[model samples]
Target: MPPHDHHHPILATQGLSHRFKPSGRGLHDITLSIPRGQFVVLAGPNGSGKSTLLRHFNGLLTPRAGTVWLDGVPVAADPARARRMVGLVFQDAESQIVGETVRDDIAFGPENLCWSCDAVDAAVRAAMDQLGLTHLADESPHLLSGGERRRLAIAGVLAMGPEVVMLDEPFANLDYPGIREVLRQVVAMHGQGRTILLAAHDLEKVVGHAQRLIIMDKGRIAADGPVVDVLPLVEQYDVRLPCQARLGMSVTSWLN
Candidate 1:
């Protein structure tokens, strides 16, 4: 892993709040700071505002009551710049796949940035290699397996070269092997010094990889701290505590 920079937060939220019409399914008074190169996991049950909060990080959802800052600049000031700095991969990878081929999909972001042909090609190749998708470069994204599609979605975001990457429910709908593959890629990204923020309900799948674990309940932050210290109480907030933690064993691997 690269050196950590403690000077300023890469992403910060100050009393951030939002609400959806009729249902009001959104975040409330969320205040937090994520430093550069930190692998953070935002865990919670369904409807806990994990997705909503992740959207706010990149201006996908506007803050109805508070503010979000990206590298000390308000996200509201320049939503486009903030989005460029932070990339989000939705839980349903198929929803984000636009191009017919995997290579074309991965190249979309860089193309939009108006990168030179060589630069776009380089980025696409690098991202595909990173996600183990080079073999499937010519395949149709829609025809890929669940895990392959998920990796393609992540590769698309990585091609844009964002500083921070947020994935919402990345492990959902995947088999054990698929889960492991995604977990491995996530760890590799963190090793490259990219700040990682993944939201998921399955703590056992990612708690071992996270430096900090945050629990959310009813669209609010319930707990935030080191994974070890906070894992014990995760069950109290309706999120499951890793079985190993409950059995008095160390959480050393997600595969376990």
Candidate 2:
């Protein structure tokens, strides 16, 4: 189906660009509008600035020249407020774990926002229960399996209850089951109306799940549109499209 006429965007980047070294792989003139309740994937090969760009949406990194907006308000205008609305889950679970126990770690986000004890406790229980990690609530993150840690890291974000969730390579080193577990949690979240923005080098999981696709090359917005418009970027850039999407291509009218 084509996009409906919704005017409000939960996340928008205007002419966003960044560079570490001139002409190196960094974002440039990248503009995007992600509407609420949509699952969008930022797809590209490695070094495409997908992670860097993901950082901008949540205020971890601000554009040197352009603007990042959240819910119609420029993100730079109020970094604190913007951060509260958006949650960024880094690809590595080790990068996110900080507390001594799972429960405490999951409570970190809400606690940082000064949430009340009762609210934080309720959030901790609800997030753990939602992810089926209620039993791991007291264990150290180091003791967790890679898949469990990934889920726990995300649970930390869920405890905060942000409006938009940005995942940077959620399945980076996952085995088959770990990948499936991550995908299942993401899909479940999507069903509940949370805006999902994923940066996946592994595009297979995104083929049928993401409603919008953005392909970045070097630092530029190479392509932006529905999956129908952007899927060929895989071939154009000599990258492989997921098998499912490729299979659909033979009879998929919307594809090129």
lDDT scores for all predictions?
A: 0.90, 0.83
Q: After superposition, how far is residue 107 of candidate 2 from its true place, in Å?
A: 0.4
Model 1 regions more than 4 Å off? 1-6
TM-score of each: 0.96, 0.91
- lDDT over C-alpha atoms for residue 173 of model 2: 89
Q: What TM-score quantifies how close candidate 1 is to the native fold?
A: 0.96
Maximum-lDDT candidate: 1
Worst 10 residues of 1 by lDDT: 1-10
Model 2 lDDT tens row, 163-229? 8889999989888787778788888888888899999876776557888888877878788888877
Model 2 spans > 4 angstroms off: 1-7, 22-24, 248-256
